[model samples]
Target: MKMTVFGAGYLGATHAACMAELGHEVLGVDTNRGKLAKLEAGDVPFYEPGLPEVLRRNIDQGRLNFTDSYAEAAAWAKTHFIAVGTPQKKGEFGADLSYIDAVIDELVPLLTDDAVLFGKSTVPVGTAARLTTRVSQLARDVDVEVSWNPEFLREGYAVADTLHPDRLVLGTRPGGRAEQVAREIYASLIVDGVPLLVTDLATAELVKVSANAFLATKISFINAVAEVCEAAGADIAALSDAIGRDPRIGRQFLNAGIGFGGGCLPKDIRAFMARAGELGADQALTLLREVDGINMRRRTRMVEIVRAASGTLIGSRIAVLGAAFKPGSDDVRDSPALNVAGQLQLNGAAVTVYDPHAMDNSRRLFPTLDYSTSAMEACEGADSVLVLTEWPEFVSLDPTSVSDVARGRNIIDGRYCLNRQDWESAGWTYHA
Candidate 1:
């Protein structure tokens, strides 16, 4: 199968590369000259576990290529995947669909024959229908078919999810060819018994937002329990362990920590809330507002716990372990861990932050905050340490050695990743 993925971003790049790896000829098109040049040179600008290798290998195999020209893309393939970013609008909860609009604006006029455009970005419901109308106006010789095919790849596990998704979803009109082609495109993954669900475009658009909303709700639900634990003197880690063992209410996102903050969850929930309100179902998602508030408050509360443990924080050295949202990737967008460090810095604390891969990216986001090359270096001479993100290295740190390095042996297990008894046994005052 030949395809064009319009937008060589995190999603598009991974999708294009993986599609190529799966024996499809894929041309990735992006208007950004620099990104196209980088891709052409086999350079991936972002850090995703195992992505660069797959991208480089596929490009070497001649199955994948990238270009800045939409004409090149439209002329090359019948299957076009609109994989651009539908970022949260500035000062508005709705997503900014301008990039998506621009893709159709640029590509449709140039499309010479009948083709299918599968929208892969998280979009407002009804966008596919609206786009279908707009695209027909742009085309001359051919009619453009628009369908919704929202992607569900987690950032760190994009390749595996794309290659072996738990399920494949395609939203199209009744008796549409888009669904059939999508099935063929994902045939190998489907043959392994990956469930495929086809539905109307509106339903498909809602699926991505709904999935993200559920995840955000789950994380906030556990954090709410953590708040209860704080008041009642209960250990959230122990409670999470006990509840997690029950198969019904599984403990996947039940980590009672400074809750989820990444590119997806925060924006998606807010956008969903805003969209629901527009759809006159505001009451249905009002809980998400509380969820967002609870998640944000944890960062502030974690800072307060650290300040209390350190006595006066005005001149105290605080080491914040973990700057990324979660480990395995350097991306720090809407990072809860970094948010705590920033708040602490504002309250006159000298905060030194560290993450295995995100320290450099963290420094870029907050250059004023001191960054350390190693987790141990970060903890050196600190009045208190806050385990913000549960990076494996932070979890495995020897509490005794950490205690010896710090000015005051104060540990605030914000993520509850540490063994509280071990830190206390090492002569450290623990606050979680």
Candidate 2:
């Protein structure tokens, strides 16, 4: 199958490359010339583990390409996947659908024949049906079917997730040809035992946001427990271990840390709540507001812990261990780690950050904060160390070596992944 994926950002780029890896010819289209140029040159604009190699291999094998023109993309492939961003609107919780709307507006007018547009962007419910009507209005003498096929790729593991998805969902109107087209596009995965759920368009649109909302709820639930444990002088790690052993409550996002943050969860829950309010079912999702609050409070708690550990943040040097939201990707949007670092910086603390892959992105997001090449370098003369993101390297750091470099042997484990005994043994005051 040959397909054009519009909006070549994180989701679009990964989907394009992974589609090519699945033995399809893929053209990634975007308005950003720099992003297109980077993709064409086999350089991924963002940090994703194993994505660069997959992209490079697919492009080198002549199965993947990129372009900035929607007309060219329309002419190139009958199948189009809209993987554009539907980020939260400024000063509002609802998603800004201008980008998704622009893709349809630009491409539908240029289509001269039959086409199928799979909306892979996470969007508000009923968007696909609305876009279907819009596509019908714009397309001339052509049969264009709009379907919802939301992506479930994680940032760090996007390549693996796309190449071997756990499930494939295709949402279309009754009697539409989208099912057949999607079957052909995902035939390999279907054969590999990836279950395909065929549903109405609205259900497909709801799946992605619902999944994110549930995951966010889970993280916040555990973080809320962490708060109780803090007040009770209990260890969250032990509690998590005991409860996680129960099969009904699997411990995936149960780690109680400076809670969930990324591009997706923070805005998705807010959007979900906002959408529910618009639908007159606002009370049902009211707990998500609490979830959002708990997540934000964790970052604040981290700042308080840092301030307490350092005695006084004013004129103090603090080493921030990670900047990205998580361990494997360089995405700092709504990152709790960066939020903590920023708060400390605002309070007159001189903060230095170190991350394996997120340094450049962190600098771009926060140019004022100082960054270091390595953890040791970041800790040099620091009053206290704050391990924010649980990067594996940070987890395995030699506390003795870090102690020698720091002016003060004070460490706060925001992620709760570090060994307290080891840090204490190294003569560092360990706080969780």
Candidate 3:
């Protein structure tokens, strides 16, 4: 199968490369010339583990290519996958669909014959049906079918998730050829025992957002428990360990940390709530507002903890460990770690951040904050150290070595990654 993936951002790029790895010829189409150029040169614009290798290998093998022209992409493949971003609108909770509209507007007019457009982007319910109508209007003598096939790739593990998804979903109208097309596209995974759930378009659109909403809820639920534990002088780690033993509640996102923050969870929940409100079922998702609130509060609470640890934040030197939302990726959109660092900086604290892969992106997002090449360098002359993201290197740091660099041996484990006993044994005041 040969396909063109429009909007070559994180999702698009990964999908394109992974499709090629699945023995399909793929052309990644995007409006961003710089991104297209980088992809053509075998350079990934973002940090996703294992993606660079897959992308480079596929491109080198002549199975993958990139372009910025819609005509070229339309001419190259009859099947198109919409991998564009549906980010939350500014000053609004609903998704801005301009990009999706733009893709259809640009690609449909250029199609001279039959085509199938698989919407791999997370979108509001009913969007696929609406896009189907729009495609029919714009396409010139072309039989274009629009279908919903939302992606479930996590940021750090996008390549693996794409090539070997746990389940494959294809949502289309009655008598449509989208399901057959999807089967052919993901024939390899289907043969590997991956379940394929065929459904109506609306159900497919809801799946991705619902998954993200549930995950956000789970993280916030644990963080809310962490709040109660804080007030009662109880240990969250011990509680998590005991409850996680039950098979019903496995501890995946149960780590009570600074809370969930990435490009997906925050915006997805907000959009879900907004969509529900528009549909007159707003009360059903009211708890998600609390989930959103709990997540945001964790960042503020972390800042408060830092202020208390440092005695006075006015002239404090704080070392922030990890700037990305999580380990293994350089994405910092809505990152709780960076939020904490930015808040501390605003409060007159001189903050230095260190991350294994996110330093460049962190600097781009926050140019004012000081960044260091390594954890030891960031800890130099710091009043206190705060582990915001649970990167492995930060977890295994030698407390004794860090103690020597910092003016004060004060450490706060925001992610609960540090071993308290080890730090305390090194004559450091440890706080979680």
What is candidate 3's local distance difference test score? 0.93
Q: Model 2: per-residue lDDT, tens digit, 41-121?
A: 999999988999999999999999999988789899999999999899999999999999999999999999899999999
- Candidate lDDT scores, in order, read 0.88, 0.93, 0.93
As for TM-score, the candidate ahead, 1 or 3, is 3
Q: Return the lDDT, model 3, position 143.
A: 94
RMSD of each: 1.5, 0.8, 0.9
Give candidate 3's TM-score. Answer: 0.99
Q: Which ten residues in a row have the lowest lDDT in candidate 3?
A: 303-312
Q: Report clash pairs, candidate 3.
A: none
What TM-score does prediction 2 earn?
A: 0.99
TM-score per model over all chains: 0.96, 0.99, 0.99
Q: Which TM-score value belongs to model 1?
A: 0.96
